[model samples]
Target: MKNITCIEDLRQIHKRRVPKAFFDYADRGSYAEETLRANRSDMERIKFRQRILVDVASRSLNTTILGEPAALPLILAPIGLTGMQHSDGEIHACRAAHAAGIPYTLSTMSICSIEDVASSVDKPFWFQLYVMKDRGFVKALIERAIAAKCSALVLTVDLQVIGQRHADIKNGMTVPPQWTLSKFIDFASKPSWVSGVLRGKRRTFGNLVDAMKGSNVNELSVWIASQFDQSLNWKDVEWIRSIWPGKLIIKGILDVADAKEAVKTGAQAMVVSNHGGRQLDGAPSSISVLPEIVQEVGGQTEILFDGGIRSGQDVMRALALGAKSCMIGRAYVHGLGAGGQDGVATAIDVISKELSTTMGLCGVNRIEDIDRRVLTDHLQTNAVSSPRN
Candidate 1:
């Protein structure tokens, strides 16, 4: 733990500690993963304008996200099957986020139920929603989040139809992992992981278990597959707004036209994401389209950035392009998978320190002071305007 210096260090530990199926589930993307590769490559292209002889002694990372004060401009992005990465993973991640004074967003597909996380953490974390075919069940989930006092409702609008993740297909991924001789050996190899899961609050999807009272893991998977709601449209956002009655964030906006529509929906914020390249393999990277979307709707509504944020420099890049805050999924998930709660804290600390160092070197002492000026050579401008493959 003391030797862990970067998110990649945690990721290496995660791959070693967790089962291969769950580790690859968090590490890989769908189809050819072209967009997934681009998300990182494009981010790496941006270079900072290192300034010297400027007094950055009073540097501060404090900023407000969604009108709420935060220690840093970061939020934990929602990830499905998080608890599989570590036992009670959502609760542990939420607690880590709260202790750092940053908000955590719990996925609807989490192993720990909304109530489980809400009861464990004193702060009101955010809740992410995936609108299924069953409107009644969806409404019930919303009600549960409200009852749990979730600070914000993040509506994921991209995954109306599931993408073909070849890795998951090849791995035969399943909740509680399907029993096979090979799987038994894999589980046996990671005794600590098995022990933690045995002591976990629930083995299957905590939120959906009650809804699937007599169903097995296979039956639940089939049901969830059948409930993706292919007919989902913008009208549904209006419907959700009518019922949710709180801060609403429309996630998965990556185009200028959709950004306009999200602004029209009157959402408090909209995330520019490509579902972390899990949905559309050939789509543009989120950061590449961020400037255009922000230009289109920056003032009308707050724009949050998602997709492939691995470091604090990435967060600074997103903010410089007009994101109110950045959300991270795989970075912290790796930490959770590595060492549970303490690993998550380490992930946050690494990024926070990196962001502060980046700010100081770039001659900025405040979060708002970050902008295009911190960058050198207009490198990002070329990337944003260049042709996409």
Candidate 2:
């Protein structure tokens, strides 16, 4: 197998390995995909200053995130259906993150259950939640997270309604993929992927299936679609905060006004994300909106960033722009789809090495030392031209 050197390389391998339906589920964004493209392009526009004549020795990427010490200021964002990428994908990713000294976040819709990941990994991983219409189920899920020793609770405030992804509709994407002639033919082409799936017992959404009473694999998609509470508001955030005793993170905040409100809601941190551009096609990129969100809530609460972060340089750019840390969804998922556990390890190593090299080249010795001075005014102009600006 060729060495997985970057996230793009992983994506290439993933495309070749996984079925068209699963691959597109993780790869594609919502209609128009304007915000998806903008997320990456906006980050690239921020030029870094090439400083010289500085003793860049004994560099350290070491930093603390939400009171947890990390090898670097980066977190693995929660992505649903990771198991489809690889067998027990969440467990593998969480183990890789634990070994790398970074936080791994388990999604509310993950194929692996909270207990499944918690029992497999040495360190306690963070748990992400979606506010559902069933308050009893939500409460029980929080209690289960605590039982699993999850260090933090990430409440995804957006996604009241699922966005229309043409690929998913076209592919008829669902858990335990329906066996059609085309799908069987697609699966037969990849013997290695098939073997991995057969070796694992949990092939569907493990968390949700067991969490809800009288629910089975066949009812998962319908249950999830119906459970997403449309009436979720700041009052619900307060209710969640009251139940979750650990660190609280409000995810999916793109607006500065929302960030300000999040701070007021007593959240310890807020993720500046556009749901990876899966929701709100016309929304601004996370990188483009990050600076403003930071400016508004930087002092009041920690600002974590997500959306379009595909490499280590992107992580550095986000950190330099005032994000305390950054999260990646598709990058690691690509690795999981490509080669399972080894692929995820390779992905993390690639990003960490890239982060170190980029920091050295930019004359920044530590992640904490990186700031706006290291970047050019090109990002500011892009931000100004943005529709939200």
Candidate 3:
């Protein structure tokens, strides 16, 4: 723990500690991974304007997300199968987020159900919903989230049609992981991971117990895969908005038109994301489209950024471009896989510290002070490129 200094360190430990399938689930991107690589590359292309001899006194990272005070302008993005990364992973991750004074979103496909996580955590975390073909079940899930007192509802608008991730097919990834002789040997190599998962509260998807009742692993996997509704549209968002009387955040808007439409849904916030490069392999990077989306709808609704955010500097970059806040998926998941709750805490600490240091280096003292001025002129001039149009 003392040796852990950066998110990459945690990622390396995560890859080594967790099984290959689960680690790759967080690491790999869809199809050819062109967009996945672009997410990071475009972020790197923007350079920060460093300042010197500024008042080196007090600095703060506090801000409000969704009309609520937060320790930082960051949220733990919902990652499905989180519990598979570690034992009771959602609960642990939520606890870590609460301890850090930030919001943690539980995925619809989590191993720990809303009730499970709500009971375990002291604070009200956010919930991410995937509107499936079953409207009844979708309403029920929203009702459950309401009952659990979730502070926000993150409706993922992308993923109406699933993308093909060849690694998942090759790895044969599934809930409760089907075990072959090779898998057994791999599990044997990571005895600690095996033990933790074996002693976990539920090996299968905890939220889908009723839906998957009396079904075997193969059938359950098939059912889960087929649940992504291709018919999803803005009307479904309206339906969900009617049921969920809380802060609504629409995730996965990469186009200016989509951003405008998401704001029209009466969502309090919308995320500029490309599903972490997990969908639409040829699409533009989230960062590349962020400025344009902000230009079109920055005032109409709060814009949150996601994709390729592994460091505090990355968070700063997004905020400078117009993201009111940021969401992280794989960064903290690496910490979770590496060391569970403590690892998660470490991941948060690492980023927060780096963000603070970066803030001071860039001559900013408050979150509100971060804007396009912090970026190099070259990036600002070349920002609106083919991606934005």
In order, the Cα lDDT scores of the candidates are 0.92, 0.87, 0.91
TM-score of 3: 0.98
Q: What RMSD does model 3 have?
A: 1.5
* lDDT tens digits, residue span 267-383, model 1: 999999999999989998999998888877899999999988999999998888788999999999999999999999999999999999999999999999998788776555575
* Candidate 3 per-residue lDDT over residues 118-181, each given as its tens digit: 9998899999999988888889999999999999999998999999998888888888788888
Per-candidate clash tally:
0, 0, 0
Which portions of model 2 show Cα errors greater than 4 Å? Answer: 211-218, 378-380, 384-389
Clashing pairs in 3: none
- For model 1, the stretches where C-alpha displacement exceeds 4 angstroms are 378-381, 385-389
Q: What is the lDDT of residue 263 in candidate 2?
A: 92
User: How far is 167's C-alpha from truth in model 3 (Å)?
Assistant: 0.9
Give candidate 3's whole-model lDDT: 0.91
Q: What TM value does model 2 have?
A: 0.96
Best by lDDT: 1
Ranking by TM-score: 1, 3, 2
